[model samples]
Target: MSIRPADSTSNPPPGSTSEATSEATSEATSEATSEATSEATSEATSEVSSEVSSEVSSEVSSEVSSEVSSEVSSEVSSEVSSNPTPNLDIREWIRIGTLEEIDKNGPMVVKGIVVFQHEGSLYAVENRCPHMGFPLHLGSVCDGVLTCHWHHARFDVCSGGTLDPWADDVPAHAIAVQNGIVYANPRPKQPKNLDWHLHRLREGLEQNLSLIIAKSVVALVNAGVAPARIAEVGIDFGTSERSAGWGPGLTILAANLNVIAKLDTYGQILALVQGLVHVARDSAGRPKRHMLQPLPATEFGTPRLQEWYRRSVEVRDIDGAERVLLTVLGGDASDADVADMMIVAVTDHFYLDGGHTLDFHNKAFEALAAIRPELRPQVLSSLIPGLGNPTRSEELQNWQTPVDLVSPLFAAFRELENQLGRISPATLASGTSDSPTDRNASSIDGSASSIEGSASIMPSQTSPLLTDRQTRTDAEKIVDVLLGDDPGVIVETLTALLTSGVDPVHLSGLVALAAAKRIVHFHTQNDFGDWIAVLHTFTNAHAVHERLKQSQNPLATRAIYHVAMRIYRDRFLNIPSAALPKSDAADRAGYSTDLRQLLALTDKQQQVAEAATWVAHYIDTGQPMGPLWNTLGHLLLREDAEFHSFQMLEAAIKEHEDWEKSTRSIAKDAMRTLVLAATRYLAAHAPTARELPQVARIAWRLARGEKLFAE
Candidate 1:
């Protein structure tokens, strides 16, 4: 009787009838049995004399026959039966077809193995292409090369070595030819080890190899390596290898840690891929840094460890610094303690490399939190090279500042910290118990005062002295005054507008626009220090206006005034704003389309001016600002990665006001400022232009009634 392996399907081989299938199946069983018995007898006789060998041969023959008979019977029955059950054991060599049958079919797929005949030789490989998981059985084979139909990734049929770098290497299996039948080992070869994959990931980053980067990421993720660890390697390599020190790549990685973590497995991989590509591109052809060895582990308290870490970082001892950090993190140190230490270390020097060092430090901590605690040491180790080798010395202005702005800024931040206490900005505004003031009492008093004030300046009761048209005209004058030499006049105008029952929110919006103008017009050669401050003030004013929509807080007016005053003081440095055509008021759809179009412009100055004007126009037309905001929010989320971007985004999100109830003028001005800030960010960061289409799609979707914010 011929034996057929289990998992052999009932389907006839290509170009073979049912009769031929039965004949082949029976022949396989008989051949298997004969081969087994013949081998058993030969082994029995070779080991003993003829007289004793006869008895041994009988026993061996019977045993081999019984076992082979059972296997053959079961396999043949399954193959011949109408319903053939698949074999669960993938390691078993299943009979797919004869060599001639494989040749007739071109390639035969059996139990995930692709068995094909080339030049009278049988070859079997995993059915899936290594490049994109495309089916290889459908691919064409010529001159011993198998070419994937989709991406045209070519591979050697016999060796499974890929001709294309993007395809990597496909897993090929051993093929057994017995009795003219082709049997394939269905179990694919095991993938590369974690260390090997990690090495490839590093190579990808070093050489800016995208396909290798993608393959390594997938392999690592599939191997159960933590996403955080994978992300850390990319972050570390990008930051350390780049000659320019920290950059938008590191900032982008830091900014999107939370977003990346929340994405599905594939999305997370793609996010890392994009981030690593930026790092690689930024660092390509730059001097490569060698990894440092850690000092011997020693017992130290948190304070001592922190001191050691700081000292190590100060001396550019990458290994020592990371070991110290890892030690602290490995211990019972609280997250706050670790954060405090990191903050101190980063701030020890002012404007560390155009503020990138501080930004990277903050983002590192943020990214660190997303990782598993056990894996943090690995992540910290990866970041140490960048930390120790910052491009700080290259920033000569930071070192040779004529004025000591650093100390004053630090002092101001310290004062704010003291005032704020332990409560974060988010909790402070939301009336949490952690807030310094009594939430209920403050809300009641604030609301009552606001109600009383609004009654006096109510839209229904106010005179037509400052009509909507006049308010817009006055808002424009405020902008003109802001650009003028007289600071006192600008302040007076801002105060007058607020007191004259011109909507405070609207007035604040104008102040924000002026603040943003200060940023746009800023032409000083100062390092990243004061220029960033201008951006913060504008975003802050925008945040204040959003808060004012909910409650008429006196503090909101004060914040707006301060921002306006700052803009006025910086007027001497103001360059003329770009001469862009004014946009006409349009419907939400039209405006959304316009925003997308503006974002595509290669000229940053033009993009910023046009976007700001368009937003102002939409607001002036009294269209709902929520959808526009939603669109802006999406763009920020996708591209903005700088510390300032985070601050602006945070401020935009903190305003828990009903957008629909916001005064049109205030909403317009506030949005204009916010959009201008976003445009400035895009100008600086220069995120991939390919993302524009996706951004446009999101904006269009919102216009078509999709939720602005996904739950």
Candidate 2:
């Protein structure tokens, strides 16, 4: 997403959502399946610069066509019998807004998903408003409740349970994140849902057949056979039991000897074996249809000749197929390419989600790491496109979600490094390695034992820098330069760190730097939602740090608070116009608290002044300001106004003294601000001047001397 250049001297209107809905992916690409057209909403247009206003408006209008189509289908489908199963699985993975896209209390919609990120993980539910099927992505996240933007319905994201008095709960999807990328895999279809089952079956059949045919056509072409002749052969194989083996069986048997050796050593073989065993062993101890029937149907020929065959193949260990493929391809290919092909082949048979296995990924990383160190970053860049700008840190966090399944991958890379003699046993086992003296010789071959103890290698944790600050600066600089020049630097660095179990905060800091520069914009192609989210996260941590430091080391609080206030101001005042307006009273109060917290960054005296100013504004403007005004006014009266230490100590002796003093010290002063003109008018009619002063004095006595302004 691109960041718009705001006028440095002018603040936008309050409640304006100009930057909220950033222009995210110009084109959507699916993570699990082929691309699907994205549905953009009115909020998305809120961020359009005046220059591109017409273009965005036209794009939005175009989206209405799709909405109309969905509505028509929904109406028609409503008449049909209810189908509990999903019609589509593996729909495209959308670039949902960045962590910042959804405000603390705002709901963000991407495609048809209602998503919001809190802490570090993301939560998504179908966007249809549960009450009336209005889009919930336009809703709000308030005090852990997702309140629908339409009809005021509510749902608890943690349970997907409806809180609205009139609504029933709707379906929510399971969200998976890997390396800052967010994935939503719809809840699996129930077996009893026959309609859903049919849909899934049709989808699977189409996908499997397409893959099979593509491979078969490629194989036949390589064998110098004609397409018509291949069709004839395939037709014969459809019915003849012995000929059935000619398809997938022969496909696997094509691998050569060298490829077989690599397959034997690769860890993915274990993952494949495990998956195949599970898929083959259905719930009732029967084989799954795909596992047993290598081909669901074979249509042999055109008008002159026609034939069809469908049958289940006999049992055979999945490994046997792998062994055959390796034997055929090994001698003719390099280990890497051969391994890549083996992975593809294994992935197809296993029906894996990513079309890749953990071992293959590990092997890929290992291969990349073993090559020239300078080139490894480029390879990583392909895996993660927007790496350097920390805005994709959520993408990284999402990336880490997939690590559990991909952890064994590190082992593969480590083993590869070990084989190349680039990593020593000590480093592999303990994260501490002795340097080899012959640097060039050490990494040149499959094994370099000659410089075992002679090489000068630094341990992973020990950098030459002396102070944490220096190390941080160096790391930040490296990250900045890499982010600016190489797309993969951030991903590579972060992956390495995650694999090492390093603290995420360090990585978060680097990401914050990128966000600060507006490099990683995931909210939209032209938005800064991603940047804002990262900044909000970082500043929150800083705020906590300041709070902690106040107790442990008072000296650090001022600096940290200052930094936090700067972030809060930028985030709060600059919220994009696309952001939905706050509807819930409690939510607006929370926002007031956020502002108060920001104001607390100033001194005790200034804090009171600011609080008074805010309270006056709240009362006059009808803003549901926070509940801290009483305490702040108290502090202002005692500490600043010095109303307590007066010859009025005699008047303070009267029964109504507290009230009189409070009115004079607090109310009289609050009336002066231009913003409080309305408030002053209202107070004049509420109580007599004599009675108001007495009430204020009583409040001053009740309040403790500490600053009541801090919210």
Error of 1 at 327 (Å): 5.1
lDDT of 1 by residue, 1-711 (tens): 223432233322322333433443334445653453244334322332232235643553443333222232222222223222233221134556765676566789865568766654556777767665567888988888989897899988876878886567776765544455665543333324466678878987777766677666655655557777887777667645665455667655555454453355554555566566667777788776544444456666787787777666656776677667777877777876766555445434333444445445545555665555554555445556567656532123322233222222222323333443532442222233422222322322322123222221112232222334464345556666666654434444554455445676666555656666666555434343555766655555554454344333332344444455446445545544433224563343265445455445423432444455565565565656555555454445445244466444433333223222556454544444444455444444434344523432332332222332333
Score residue 681 of candidate 1 by CA lDDT: 45
Candidate 1, residue 100: how far the Cα is off, in Å: 2.9
Task: Name the lDDT of candidate 2.
Answer: 0.29
The segments of candidate 1 whose C-alpha lies over 4 angstroms from its true place after superposition are 1-98, 104-114, 126-129, 132-165, 171-208, 215-248, 259-270, 279-333, 378-573, 578-606, 613-672, 683-711
Summarize candidate 2's per-residue lDDT along 494-538 as a digit string, tens digits: 334434433333333333333232211112222423333433333
Q: What is the C-alpha lDDT of each candidate?
A: 0.51, 0.29
Model 1: how far residue 181 lies from native, Å: 7.6
Error of 2 at 156 (Å): 50
Worst 10 residues of 1 by lDDT: 451-460
